[model samples]
Target: MSPLLLVVAAAGGVGAGLRYLVDRLVTPAAGARFPVGILIVNVSGSFALGVLTGLGAAVAPELSLALGAGLLGGYTTFSTVSVETVLLAERRRWRDAALNLFGTLALTAVAAGLGLLLGSAAA
Candidate 1:
């Protein structure tokens, strides 16, 4: 195994751990009505990815791969979003379900765009 692979794996583990902690911290405050935790994670992860992408050649390829495919990859949770949206729908909370689904998509895109702009300017 390559050293870069090992680094990415370790980063992924750390990202997953951070995701868990963020969920634990946010869920209670946001309440059971919506899956705010996962939404936040996905959005933030997207933004981070955008920044990494925008940085482009400014950052080393290895570092970019490690942060994007490793850390943010582990941090985001599209699967969880799907499950939660389905659960909300099954529970007959159509508004929350739709919001969770569409809201996440919209928010993440915008966040990523903003991050890209910021990162590109810095670069």
Candidate 2:
């Protein structure tokens, strides 16, 4: 394997591990009514992606690869989010499911914007 791919793989491993730990830690406290763990992960990952993309434009491309492609790519849980949404709908929690779907979109958009704003503001 190439050296660059190795770094990426390591970053992905770390990101996945971190995500699992965080989800486990947060879910028990928040309960089943809300999939708060995945929500937090997705939103945070969105924000980080934004920050990295903004930074890539402002600075180095390599940084974006490390932080955005490596970290956020592994960290985000699109599959899990989709599955959970489906489960909610299957259980006839259509309102909750719809809210989750829309809410994730809205919140991720806001978070990405916020990340860009914050990144641009920083030195």
Candidate 3:
């Protein structure tokens, strides 16, 4: 494998481990219905990805790919969020489902944009 690919592979493992750790730590407090774990990771991932993108011009392409495409990509859980939302709706928790869907969308967008601005300023 290419050196860059190896780096991304390692980063992906790290990201996945971190995701699991964060979920384990936060899920109980987030409650069983809300799925705040996925929400947190997705938003955080978006922010991290935004920072990488904002620093794209100033940073190495390989570093960006490893963290953005590999790390954050693994850390984020869109599929799980979708499944959880669907399950919530199926279980008649319409409010929680809607909140999860809209909340994740709104928060992640804001986080990404904020990260971009901050990262650009820092760069």
Candidate 4:
């Protein structure tokens, strides 16, 4: 395997570990009423990706791939969001479910846009 691929894989493992730690830390404070942990993870990941994208030619392609596709890919998770939404719906918490689904989408998009703008300016 390529050395770059190995770096990305290692970075992904680190990212996943970070995700787990963040969730564990935030979940308790946010409580079981909502999955605030995952929400934070996705939004932050999206923003970081936007920054990398905005950096454009300033960042090397290999570094970008390792951080974007590897680290952030593992850091952010739509699957958890989907499962949580379904679980909320199953419990008949329609409002929370809708909020989780739509809210996350909207928030992450905005975060990414903002990150892009900032990243571009910095670049």
Best by TM-score: 4
Worst 10 residues of 2 by lDDT: 54-63
- Prediction 4 TM-score vs. true: 0.98
Q: Tell me which of candidates 1 and 2 scores higher on TM-score.
A: 1
Stretches > 4 Å off in candidate 3: none
Alpha-carbon TM-score of each model against the true structure:
0.96, 0.91, 0.94, 0.98
In candidate 1, which residue pairs clash?
none
Q: Order the candidates by TM-score, highest first.
A: 4, 1, 3, 2
What tens digits encode model 2's per-residue C-alpha lDDT throughout 53-96? 66656756665676677778888888888898999999999998
Q: What residue pairs clash in candidate 3, if any at all?
A: none
- The lDDT, on a scale of 0 to 1, for candidate 3 is 0.88
Instruction: Summarize candidate 3's per-residue lDDT along 12-122 as a digit string, tens digits.
Output: 899899999998889998677578788889999999888888876798887788888788888998898899999999999999899999999999999999989988988
Q: For candidate 4, lDDT tens digit of each residue in 9-97?
A: 99899899999999999999989999999999999999999999999989999999999989999899999999999999999999999
Best by lDDT: 4
RMSD of 2: 1.5
Reference-based TM-score, model 1: 0.96
For candidate 4, the 10 contiguous residues with the lowest summed lDDT are 114-123
Residue-pair clash count for candidate 1: 0
Model 1, 17-40: lDDT tens per residue? 999999989999988788999999
Model 2, residue pairs in steric clash: none
Candidate 4 colliding pairs: none
